[model samples]
Target: MRVGCPKEIKNHEYRVGLTPGAVREYVAHGHEVLIESAAGAGIGADDSAYIAAGARIVGSAKEIFEKSDMVVKVKEPQPQEWAQLREGQILYTYLHLAPDPEQTNGLLASGVTAIAYETVTDDRGGLPLLAPMSEVAGRLAIQAGATALQKANGGRGILLGGVPGAIPAKVAIIGGGVVGLHAAKMAVGLGADVTIIDRSLPRLRQLDDIFNGRVHTRYSTIGDLEEEVFAADLVIGAVLIPGAAAPKLVSREMLSGMKKGAVIVDVAIDQGGCFETSHATTHSEPTYEVDGIIHYCVANMPGAVPITSAHALNNATLQHGLALADRGLRAIAEDKHLRNGLNVHKGRITNHAVADALGHEVHAPENLLYVA
Candidate 1:
């Protein structure tokens, strides 16, 4: 199988799909790997590194895309790259289709076999591929929110970890999953009072056990979230719905009630945001003010730290890539877990969640592919 690694082209995106080590692994398995020039430069892996690992360096993304049977990427394809996709080509990437109708339509039109990394599940029902980036984004959520809280950034001028005789900031995290857990851990480490809300009591109980009373957990209702928002110094919207649009838990009215200078870092912005006022921002211009609240809604939060993000992501995704490459889609079509990653195959929406989100009929990949 011929695999291509293209440099991420989204605005402010610097994470590459594959690393030199990943290339070496594929080459060791007798698969041909083509890396576009400078693809790994963001992660500090030069073309020479990939060449040293037995990868062929290509001149352009067009060459990589056109030549490879499978294309691995960190983000969804942009408009220009979408045109390069051909029927029967395999795209393995973080395709957050629920949030973008344009991307969904483009992939449907291209007839590529799209396997979304974010939707792939492990045996325990956790999103395997999405977890790594979520961990990165969750940690960065606090960092960004704290920075935005500085008076220079139009915040309340209060420190996250207040000095003696000064009150510490109140952080309300809206979800108890990976993102919220990491955010709470960071906030609590910084001595800020942290509260995390979720719909799962069992999960909340687990959080309680893990944090040992260091972090507060609450059952999230609109009223509960509204009250928390009003009192919060930093509000981190970390809600996720797995291959679907994030539920808008924080409404515009809720934002108006939030304290002035409160910073909101919506970690789920890539899934269409849990905050009503949230819009995708770039790392270059990461924040905007709405109703006296600061919003840090950078869609690709991990991209801000490409070196760490790329390596972490590749660690999680490489084995799956190899599985898909070695076994081909026919074998994957037989595995229920891998089939769940299939978003679009042969111009049809193969994932029910994506189909429902886009108002299209779902085609089971098993039905689309012939059994050996």
Candidate 2:
């Protein structure tokens, strides 16, 4: 199989879909690898390194997209890239289609087999491919929120970890999943007073045990979240609904009750955000004020640290990627977990969550592909 990778073109996106090390693995597996020139520049891997790993360096993204049987990418295809897709070609990347009807339409029109990394499940029912980036995004949320809280950055001028005789900032994380857990780790480590709210009592108990009473955990309720949001200095929106649109936990009216100059880092912004006022921001201009509350809603927070995130992502994706490269649709037919990754195949939505979110009927991949 011929696998190709193109450089990410999103705003301030520096992660390459295929690393030099990852290319070497593909090469070792007897797969031909093509990488567009400077595709690895974000992670400091140049053309020479790819060449050293036995990957042919292509001159342009156009060539990579046009020639490769399977296109591996870090972000979803942009508008121009979408037009280049064709029937029978495979697109392996993060496709947050629940929120973006345009992208979903583009994939359908292109007749491409699109497998979304974010929706891929493990045997344990965990989203394996999305975990690495989630971990990165979670950790970055606190860092970005802390910076946004500085007075010059349009925040409340409060130090996250207050000094002696000064009260520490209150952080309310609206999920107890991977993102919320890591965000709490960073927030608590920085000496902030942290509270995590979630709908799952079992998960809340797990979080409480993990934190060992260092941070607060609350059962999610309308009143519970509102009370926490109103009292918090920094709010991290970390909720997720798998491939579906994220539930908006905080409304615009609720923002009026929040502390003035407080910061909100919506880690769920890629899935359409858990905050009513949230809009996808770029690292170039990461924050904006809504009702005097600072919002840091960078959609690609992991893209800010490509070196760490790219390697981490590649680590999680390599095995499944190799399975696809080796057997293509047969791998999806054989592995239920990998089949869950199939969002679109041959002009149809195959993932139930994505289909329901986009108001389309689900076409199970098993029906779409012949089982070997």
Candidate 3:
């Protein structure tokens, strides 16, 4: 099997699909690995490092896309990269297809077998591949929200953890999942008053136990959400719906009711955001004002810390990627969790959530793969 990794070309995205260590694993499995020149530069691995790991360094991304049987990447293929995809080629990456119609349509048109890391599941019904980046994004949300709350950034001139005489800033997180939990940890660690709201009572109880009653847990409701949003200095939108678009919990009308200069960090922006006003921003200009509310909606927040993000992502994805390299579609047919990762295979949408989200016809993985 031939596996290829091209440099990530998204705005300010630096995480590569495979690390040198990951490449070494593939090579050891009798698979030939090809990496674009300096593909691992974001993670501080040079061409020489990949060469030492038994991966051949290709001169250009074109060469990699043209020659490899499977194209492994960190982010979704850009227009040019998708254009280069051909029938029967496998694209293993985080394709947040529910949000981006253009990319989804392109993949369908290309006839490529697209496996999305974000949709991949574990035996525990958890998104294993998406967890590492979610953890990073959740922690970074607090840091980014704190910065966005500064007066110079057009936010209320309030510190997250106030001084002896001042009141601490209030933080309201709108989910109790992986991202919300990590955000709560960061916010609470800074002595900020934190509240997490979720619909799942069991999850809320778990959070209460984990936080040891330090952070407030609330049952999510329209009235409760409004009250929390209107009162908080910072609101973190951390809701998710697996492979579907994030439910818009905060509407434009609600923003006007929020405190003037308040900050909102939509950690769910990758899945089309839980806040209605969020448009994907880059690290260079991470925040924008909407109805007097500041929004931090960087789609690739983990990319801001590529070194840790790359290693963590590779650790989670390497095994599944290796399975695909070793046995192609058969690996997905054999593993139900891996089969869930199949968003588009051979021009059909195979993931129900994604198909419904995008208003496309859904094809069962079993039917598509001709599994008995």
Candidate 4:
């Protein structure tokens, strides 16, 4: 199998798909690895590193996409790269297709095997590939929110950790999953009064046990969320619905209830955001004011720290990449968890979540991979 790694082209996106170490492993397994020139440079990896790992450096994106049996990437393919996609080639990446009708249509027209990393599940029902980036985004959300809270940034000019004898900032985190948990950890560590709200009691109990009363856990309800947000200095929207778009838990009306100049870091912006006002922003223009509330809704928050994000993402995605390369898509189709990752195959929407998201008919991956 020939695998291709392309440099991310999204604005402010610096993470690369594969590292030299991953290239070496695939090469050692008797597979060919083609890396686009300067693909790893954004992640602090160079062509020489890939060459040392036995990878062939390709000059153009066209050659890499045209020659590879499988195309691995970090973000979804942009409009230019979308034209390069071919039928039967496998695309393994974070395809957030729910929000973008154009990307959904593009993948369908390309007739490729599209396996979304965000939807891929582990045996424990955890999103393995998405977790690493979620952890990074979660931690970064606090930092970004803190910066946005500064007076110059249109915030209340209150310090998160606060000074001696001053009141600490209050943080409200929506959801209790990986992203929410990490945000809570970071906020609490900074001495901010933290409150995590979730629908699951078990999850809230787990958070309670983990934090040992340092952070408050609330049974998530409309009233409870309203009360928390009304008093919050920073609100982090971290809700996710697997391959589907994120639920809008915070409405535009809710914004008026928050303190003036409070910041909202919607980490789920990639999944269409949980905040009603969030539009995908770039790192260069990461925040905007909505009713006196600041919104940090960068679609690729982890991309701000490419070196760390690339290595962390590579660590989680490498095993799955090897599985698809060694055993081919058929083996992945046979595995139930891996099969769930198949959003599109042969021009049909194979995942129900993605299908429902775009209002298309869902084709079972098994039906697409093998004839009955």
lDDT of 3 by residue, 206-260 (tens): 9999999999999999999999999999999999899999999999999989999
Count of backbone collisions within predicted model 1? 0
lDDT of 4 by residue, 273-369 (tens): 9999999999899999999999999999999999999999999999889989988876676688779888988889988877888899998887778
TM-score of 1: 0.98
Candidate 4 deviation (Cα RMSD): 1.1
* lDDT tens digits by residue: candidate 1, 83-104: 8998978999999999899998
Local accuracy by lDDT, each model: 0.91, 0.94, 0.95, 0.92
Clashing pairs in 2: none
What range of 10 consecutive residues in model 4 has the weakest lDDT sum?
A: 363-372
Off by over 4 Å in 3: none
| Cand. 4 Cα-lDDT | 0.92
lDDT of predicted model 3: 0.95
TM-score of each: 0.98, 0.99, 0.99, 0.98
lDDT string, candidate 2, 88-141, tens digits = 898999999999999999999999999899999998999999999999999999
Models ranked on lDDT: 3, 2, 4, 1
RMSD of each predicted structure? 0.9, 0.7, 1.0, 1.1
